[model samples]
Target: MNGLKGLYLEDLVVGQSASYGKTVTETDIVMFAGMSGDTNPVHLNQDYAETTMFEGRIAHGMLSAGFISTVLGTRLPGPGTIYLSQSLQFKAPVRIGDTVTAKVEVREIIAAKKRAILETNCYVGDRCVIAGEAVVMVPSRA
Candidate 1:
């Protein structure tokens, strides 16, 4: 994948997009928990989570959001892009074994600043799990 070159600021189109998918797994949950120190029972303790509205352990919302980061870093504007800001709404739970697909679409461009505003979304099957927007500073070829 490193052999490929990502788009520079001047190359982007308004409707450009990219996506990637990953299946949420127990290991992923645990690893993300350890890495992020988000040891919430809803994500770590099944017995504790069972009594909650989820009724079962669910993956951390941020973990699913990371998929959106992966798509941006590895695809769309690709490498060299710098994340500026993001706003996310967690719409649904992502349970273990669920396959989530993260997608990003270019919505606006600031050529002078070499920046882009993208509409980001993550879906579990037909249901949307996360919705958001991101601003990234795409590097130029100068």
Candidate 2:
């Protein structure tokens, strides 16, 4: 496939990878809370969060995880990729202003099924904030 249409199944290699980065912000957390209907105090109420293990308000875990989706949907597999499954492990807190970089690498390809298993990860500087695996159905040239 051409760049505009994303990579076709045949175009993928096991080690191919891509990444996208974004800085977490107060507006991002607030908007995510509203859009996801998860007004958890840990993510919204600073005082309340101060009592938690984080000791301060932290951006939602899913917000960081969502960066993985951004990398998949717009970067590696690009625009036509269909996400089939994902497994995630949240490891650290993401505070407002932290720049999160989401990375995805093709780990395995099942040509018969037109599917690819990718290793997905999000990092803040050198610390991994989220780690996961994703299965996606990629377009083909046939």
lDDT of 1 by residue, 1-142 (tens): 2635677988889999999999999999999999999999999999999999999999999999999999888898898788999999999999999999999999999988889999999999989999999999998887
How much lDDT does candidate 1 score? Answer: 0.93
Which lDDT value does model 1 have at 36? 96
Poorly placed runs, candidate 1 (over 4 Å): 1-4
TM-score per model over all chains: 0.96, 0.97
| Error in Å for residue 34 of model 1 | 0.6
Query: Which stretches in model 2 have alpha-carbon errors above 4 Å?
Result: 1-4
Tell me the TM-score of model 2: 0.97
The numbered model that scores best in lDDT is 2
Q: With candidate 1 superimposed using the best TM-score fit, by how many Å does residue 139's alpha carbon deviate from the native?
A: 1.1
